[model samples]
Every structure is written in structure tokens, then in C-alpha cells.
Target: MRRRRTYRLTGGLAAAGLVLLGIPPAAAQEQGGLETQLRFSQRLTQEDGTLSTTTGLGVTLSSRTRTEAFLFSVDSGLEQDFDGSALQQKDPRLILSYSRESLSSALAADFSYRQSDVDALSEDDDISDGVLRLDEGLLKRYSGNLSLQLGRDAPFGGTVDLGYSAKTYSETSDPDLLDEESVNATVALRFDLDPRISAGLRSSFSQTDRDDPGQDTDSASIGGTLDFGVTKTLSTNAYLGYSRVTKSTPGFPEDVQKGLAYTLSFTELRPNGDLSGSLGSDIDEAGRRTTARLDRSLELPSGALRAGVGLSTSEDDDLRPLLSFSYDRGLKRGTFGVKLDQAFSTDSDGEEALNSDFRVTYRQELTPLSSLQAGVVLRDTDFVDDANTDSRKLQLDLVYRHALAEDWNLVGGYSHSISDKSDEDRDHSSKVFIGLEKATRWRF
Candidate 1:
């Protein structure tokens, strides 16, 4: 089963490439190929000052047949534990693709089981999911393209009420995170109205079934996009979407909710004129909402300078506004990028929910045979009245990637992160990890 799973994972990727590259599935019989990858990771963890070690493995395989292509992959890992027990996670995925001139389709199945000795909390969870997509050309107008798809999704985004319930309504509260199995159907349409204008619309509906965890939900969403060109080099795009969800189970908390999102972006670069910016926002029915996000980018000789601002307010009587900036530069060797963001609130309760994060990414070529990358991340989050009211985290990562042979490659990397909370000294935690990957492919 493991070997088959690995092969399937690789076959799936190869098949996807063939389809996108306009190669017919029948080519597998004419010219077959193989793909695979193996990876391993070592980890160390410390919580409340105590430390432990862990290791993980991942395998995937992919290939194609005359009429179909398949992929399968599996991952396993263990974590640190305080009571002489740790965590085990096993995830396996399989995908199949079939394609023809007029019709192309994909089926994906994912199964995951995780056991953790949150020994302190006594909680265990197991979950699995399957998804399918079928795409067919409906119409090709001189102005647009249209397509439709149908599939299944296990647990998507969860509601706060649900999160709170799952936390067993702890004094501070955490909701239900379980979203029952849902079937989905959608249609997307894109139009090139003119050389200077374009538009698109997408809508989907979902029906859920009851499961062991919590209430089921039915939902639907519709969104549209419009773009216009002011000049040969200046253009703008606007987008809007609305969605709603309703609980299916009878006694479920009135899990009725609606949300709306919007975004707009503009760019101009007609010599001497260097301007680009975007605005986005979301509003939800529960009053737990977000207002807007604003971003601007400037052309610079060194690289690109970008700035952004945002607003988010929860109906729970909390309000927050945020701002940030970023810069990216490309060198002969690689690229370097950095950004920082902070959220400021109006009230004390809101203040506790404020958060900030800073990060830097740098990549450079170490030699003709290898490349290296290093990054650091720091973040602070206010948890309000939760048992742990605040969290500060810092992490560092380094990676060396290289090609081993004509059809082989290797990658080594390490990452470590730490989180600290005030008052609850026991809530502090840290994790260190290292990993290596190698892969080879053969063609026939």
C-alpha cells in the first residue's frame, strides 16, 4: 500500500502537467514516464521549559497509463509530549486525472488521522476528505470563456460559534471546528469584453451531511470581477463576492451567517508616472467583520517599495486597524524581501486582540551546484482574556537546495520557532526542525 501510494502521488503530478501542456491522456500508452520524491525531517520541541525530539517522513509516487493518470502520497510524523507521550499524524492523498479535447476531470481523495496526548487536555481527532472536479467547455464567445465543476469538501472554514463549542465553551471560549461533509457545484465565466476591458463571474452552492462531530451547514457564494485599462500601461480591476451559510442540523445553534468581500487595484506606468495600489474588505452577518485593506507599490531603482493599511472590527465590540510596509529586491544571486505589520485597536478589549508580525526572506546562490536561503520571522499576538492573553513568537529557517544528477536532486533545511506568553509562564513553547529531501525520475 505504501509503495502504491508513493507511485500514485508522482503519477498524479505528471498527469496534471500533461493535461496543462495540452498532451492527451492517450500519450501515456505511447510514451510512459515515472515521478517520485522522498523526504525526512527531525524536530525538537520545548514547552514550559521542558524539551523533546521527533522525526517525520513523506513519500509520493506518480505515473500515467493509457487512459488515466494517478498520484498517491503519504506523510507521517511525531511531536513532543510532556506526560511521556507525543503526537502521531498520518496523511495519505490520491488523485486521478482523465482528459480529452472537450472534457477534462480530476478526482482527489485525502485521508488523515492524528493522535495527540494533549495528555493535559485528553483530546483526539481523526478526519478524512475526498474531492472531485469535472470541467467541460460550454461556450466560447469571441468575448469570453465559460466552465462548470462539481465536487465534495470535508470541513472547510469553521464558524466562531463552532470553534467556541469545540473548546467546550471554555470560560474564554473556543468554537466548533467541525464542518460536516459538503457537496459543491460551481460555474465560472470570463469575458474579454474588449482589448481594454475584461470581466468574470463565479458562483457555487454546497449541501452538507451530518457527521459525528457537530452540526452540518449548507452554503452558497457568488463573486464577480471587472477590469479596465486607462492607457496602454495603466489598468484597474474591481472584485466583489457574497456568501451565506445555514446550519442543517435541527438543534444546532442558529448558525445563520452572511459575508461580503471586495477588492480594487490600479496600476500606472507611462513614464514618470509610477503608481500602484489596492483596496480590499470583508463584512460578515454575525457583526464579526472586517472593513478594508489598502496597499500601494512604487517602482524604485533598487527594487520595489510597497505599503499597506487595513481595518477589521468584530461585532463582539472590538475594533482594530492595521498598517504595514514591505520591500523586495532582486540581486544577481537571488532575492531579498522584508515586511512588517501591526494592528491597533480602539478599546482595551480590542487592544488585547491586536497583533504584529515582521519577517525577512533572503536567497542567494552558494555555488554552481547549490543554492541557499535563510529567513526569520517574529510575531506578537494579543489573546484578550483567554487563559494565555498574549503570545510572542520568533523563528529562523535555513535551507540548502541542490541538484544531484541529471534526474536527481537534494534539499536540506532547518527551522525553529518559539512562543512565549506572559503570566502563564507554563504556556511558553518552542520547536526546532530539520529535514532532507531527494528524488529521481526515469522516462521510457
Candidate 2:
């Protein structure tokens, strides 16, 4: 099996150093329980780029759990970037939990809080942001043949967990930059509702406090999915969802996000030659940013292979299409695998502005006690979108692992990456890192 080398030895070193220095650890006895981690990385660029480095240390502790049905669970973690300014400071998470179930009825509730601080290179003011989320649901099972669920989901939590907003950070804080909060409700039911058909419904509301003059908005989404079995070897799942929002800025009071996404799958469910495929799309009344995808999977005798093709066209006159394939083979020593990806893109003018990315990876187990992996990656960008965008990129990485004991293990790794942009020379750069990590854990 292939695995990502985890960073644990860095934390141990810090812990050990404190002990040898006759210094008490920051929270040795200050809290609920002790679980911590540390990681360090370096970033560098060319004369056209820049170089940066960072180390990260984090600790999470929370009140003991009640364990009783309907009780809550509380947890929290504090992380600091040694690159100091790279990832900044993060206070991520708090979760509340409750659940109850019987032969015929059940209820559940959950909530969480998360937040973080941003870096300065993003051209905005330094800022603090996060979110709070709460949800509750009730379910019932009827005659061992039917089941139903009714629930409410609220994302009013002011945290930042969205993938799109992740890479974009601010150099400063703007108290006025609105946060996001949303609320939604969903209901679903299942049965041998016939041995062939089941249905569901969902409705949700969300609002954003965006920095773009035309981006701040509020919207509600309503959608559902259907699953049907056509035969013993084939089943299908299709979902259609839509949303409409009231914009926060003038001249645009309403915005709509509607789409149809679907999939068809076939499985031996018994292990011989399982296959599946899916097609989906997201388009609106204006078709400003459109996305489409086609995916397929094959269960080969050697292992399993999956492939996908997708295209995305955005309102800003940007178009991108991507392709990927992966294969997994179980070897006697372990599991071996490989993957590939490529993306082609153009500007609004339909001119080739950027051709980005191609990557391949391989992993193998040398023996019961040792394993290794090697991979290479490359990316190219026109930087037509922004001066900060990269015009070129190259990366390579290698890793090795060996076990010390059932609970103990050691790992070492090396990685290098480079990026260049046509518009900006000062921002071009390269990064290289070599590190080792080890871990040992036990349960009381």
C-alpha cells in the first residue's frame, strides 16, 4: 500500500529538547490532554522568483467526552507556522455531538467552530476568519422495510473551509470583509420503496461577505437525488440541485446557481469485473462559469483503473480542461500504484495562454520492513490572469520508509519545486526540502 510520510519526529525533537534544557514544556500540565505535532518546510525562488521557509507546530486538547447518548464532544487545536508568516496562526475546531437510536426512531445533533489568520503576500490586510456550523436530524425505520430522515443544516459558522478561498489570503485585516453564514434543510426516505426506486429532497441558504465588488451575496439552494436499480449488475444514481441568491451589491440584487449532476454505476458487488461511469454538469441562466465532467472505471485483472475528463469555462474569459488516470495493483509485497494528470487552458480570446501540469508517481514495498516511492511533477502557466500566477513549474520528490516496531516507525523524504511567471520576475522562485520523521504511540 502507498502512504504519505507523516511529520511526527519534528514534534518529538521539540519535546526532547525542552526536557534536556531543563525547561518545562509550554502545556505539560496546563490542559486537558497532550497531543502535539511539528513540521518544517522551505520555499525558494529564482531571480524572477522568491524563497521562503516555515516550520509548523500544533497542539490539540479538549475536555473529556461524556460518552452518553445525546451528549456533546469538545475539542480544539492551536497551530503556529515556523515559516512564521507562511501559514500564520490557526485556531481550528470545536465539535459538539449527540445521537440516539432505537429499533424504530433516532435523533442526532452536531456543531463545530473553526478559524485562522492569513498571510500578507495576498495584497489584502491581515485578517481573522472562521465559521460555526450546527445540524440536527431525526430518523425512523418502518417495519424493517422502510426508512426516513428529516434534518436541518446551518453553515452560519463564520469559518473558512471552502476550497476556492483557501489559496487566496490577505496581507492585512479588514473588519468589514463580510464572513459567510448559511442555513439549510433536507429530507430523504428509502425503502424497498419498490426494489427499484428511492427519492429525496434538500433545501439550503447561504450568504457571503466577499471582497470583490460584485461578489458579496446571499442564496438558497434546493435539490435532490434518486437512486434506482436496473438489474443485478447495474444501479444508477442521479442528482439535480439548484440555488438562487440575493446579491449584497447594487445593480445586481439576484444571482442564481443551478445545475444537474448525474452518475451511472455497475458493480459485481461480488468482486469480478466491476465497472462504473458518470457524467455531470453545472450551468446557470447566464452560463458565466460552466463545468462538465465524464468519468469511467474498469476492474482489470491486474488491479483497478479509473479515468476522468473534464472541462471548465469561466466568466472571466478563462477556459480549462483536465484529464486524469490511475491504476492500482496489489503486489505480494504490498500494493503498487501509478497516476497521471494534465490540464489545458486558454484565455477569453481562445488563444493558448497556459498549458499546465503533468505528474506521475510509483510506490513499491522492498520488503516486509521497507517501502519506497518516487514521483515527478511539472506545471506551466501564462500568468495572463495575474502577475502572481506562475508561468512555469517543475517538481520532484522521493521517499523511503522502514519500521522500528509495531508502534514505532521511521521515514525520510526529499522534495524540490520551482515556479516562474512571465509578468513578474521578482516573484519567481524554487523550493527544496529534506527531512526525517519518526513516531511511537500507545493507548492507555
Whose lDDT is greatest here? 1
CA lDDT scores, all candidates in order: 0.46, 0.39
Please, what are the lDDT tens digits per residue for candidate 1 over residues 1-444? Answer: 000000000101111000011112223333356555555545444333444454555555556655445454445555444457545332212223333221233333323322211111100111011110011111110111122222212111111101001111111112222223335566655666667787878676765554434445567778998889988888898989987866544554566777786778888774533566666664322223554666667767879887877666665645566778888898998888887766533111112245566768788888888887777766566543355345565655565566666533354444444445554542222323233333333343
User: For model 2, what is the alpha-carbon lDDT of residue 193?
Assistant: 46
Worst 10 residues of 2 by lDDT: 132-141
lDDT (Cα, tens digit) per residue for candidate 2, span 125-241:
111222110111111111101122222222111111111122222332333223333333333433334657766555544444444442454555556667788877678877677
TM-score, model 2 to reference: 0.52
TM-score of each: 0.51, 0.52
